[model samples]
Target: MATEYAFDIASDLKTVQALELLSRHISGLTLTWNGKNRDYLVGSTINISVSEQLRSWQETILEGFGFTPTLSVGFRFHNNTDFDAFSEIMFQATMLLLEHAEDAVLLFNYEIIVLQRLGGKLVFNAGYQMWDDDWLKSRLSLPFERRPLPSPLL
Candidate 1:
């Protein structure tokens, strides 16, 4: 069974600056053309299988000054197989982002769902407890807050 967890990290820098910081600190970070919209872009870090779409208010004061950077990232891992490896990737990526930002917020995006195979069918169970011991928490000494995902899961 596979489970997915998502989170957001907002930074105090502009979109360009945040991208630059991530490019410098994050390994295997790449810019991919957004196939749906040519003008838009997506960023991915190979280590954790995390992808981010950064956006800011369209007002010139915000986009021009590069003062507001909102980043949305997610991780999908198999509960029975890839949890530890992917979770570790998530931790490392989070650490790198926070290190380069002046301010950041990590928002819990969805109920951690544990899936199990039952007679060839998959069942979903709330697994939020799994998050309490997540390695990302262990890496950050500062207190962090959790908030709902920006959008509900499908």
Candidate 2:
């Protein structure tokens, strides 16, 4: 079986705004909209989608984290590819969303990767064992705070 890699973020940003922001900041990806769903094809390898609604359990979990999510952005990876490049894009995308949304939480493979609240403060997690922000920062090379990335209009 192929290893499954997925990331989901529950955020207060509207679907349109999320799509727009992602399309602008993350380069070399194109988003095609169909009704409420937006699909991003990453070099014919990974398929990404935006979900406007959340399941009851998802909502409950977000609330437990002190977040009131309005919509969810989900990325589903179906095939193997250049994982390093994929990770970079995912990191950039997560930062972009967290920067713009007031309350947002990201889940990787159904595990909480990181979360932001009150518009600025961010919390990082590595499963239930490790909760060190430094570890996460070094692993992903992620900045402790938000920073601007070059945006190429989509």
Candidate 3:
């Protein structure tokens, strides 16, 4: 059976900066909607939805990106076997936003929602967290070496 899950992130990074970071880091995976290629440039919005159902399992992926000086990236994945993969991707994206806005004291907020059917009824579990620069830095592994450098020699 397919499950519904979503990750919503809010950060101070500009749309262009966020988009650039995602485009660079998440190149390995193709984020398309319904298996169709879509243009997601700076200042542009992206919304993709795809679904597949087979026998005992159904899978769906919905991803959207919006730019408004502050960037919002939402990812919805159904029946995901592992959450680590999702966290890894979000971590990378967050790190990129932080790197771009160095001097700015930024805030980060994220929410995860999972929906499941129980007893023939739909149920959802949702949680959200907000953190400042200090807390985020302390809780997250944002090492200097992991950050992208303009010059490799640096």
Candidate 4:
């Protein structure tokens, strides 16, 4: 069975703008819509959605940071069987969105991973430790390198 991973990004850009950005940058994905749900599908594996609404709590938090996010982008890896592939795609898409967004916050496991303000300042939170952009990028870029296990005792 495949494990599911989900992430949400709060951005100042509207839903249409976010969709356009992703459509332009990421190729080979089919876009579809149903009511307010706009989904970008990668076969039956990945689904990215954009909505004009933000959770009330998210809106309040972004407001506290002086950013009024106009929409929320949700990335769902429904059929993620390989951790490395999932990590790479998530990291790349998150970075691309952050670059163009006026202000954005990335949430995973209900915790804030990275928050960027309009002034180009990024704050990364990983438990008790803090991370810089380059550090986070480097870590995500490689995901996990495969290594051969030690031979069993002979």
Point to the candidate with the largest lDDT. 2
Query: What's the number of clashes in each of the models?
Result: 1, 0, 0, 0
lDDT of 2 by residue, 1-154 (tens): 4433333444567777777788888777777876545544343444556666567745664555655566666665545677656555666777677666666655555444443443455554433332355545665543454332121111
Model 3 collision count = 0
Q: Write the per-residue lDDT of candidate 3 for residues 14-57, one digit (tens) a residue.
A: 44445555676754444332333232322112221212212222
Provide the global lDDT of candidate 1 against the true structure. 0.40
**How well does model 4 score by local distance difference test?**
0.54
lDDT of 1 by residue, 1-154 (tens): 3454443444454445544555566554454434442211223312223234434321321332223335544555534455555555555555666654443323233433222221222222333334443543566565444333222223
Q: What TM-score would every model get versus the actual structure?
A: 0.41, 0.65, 0.35, 0.62
As a TM-score, model 3 comes out at: 0.35
Q: Clashes in model 1: which pairs?
A: 14-66
TM-score of 2: 0.65
- Superposed model 2: Cα runs more than 4 Å off: 1-12, 36-45, 55-58, 112-119, 126-154
Better of 1 and 2 by TM-score: 2
Per-residue accuracy of model 4 over 13-59 as CA lDDT, tens digit each: 67777777777777656667666456554534466777765578456
lDDT (0 to 1) per candidate? 0.40, 0.55, 0.32, 0.54
**lDDT at 115 for candidate 4?**
34
Output the worst ten-in-a-row residue range by lDDT, candidate 2.
Answer: 145-154
Model 1 TM-score on a 0 to 1 scale: 0.41
lDDT of 2: 0.55
Question: Ten-residue segment with the worst summed lDDT in candidate 1?
Answer: 115-124
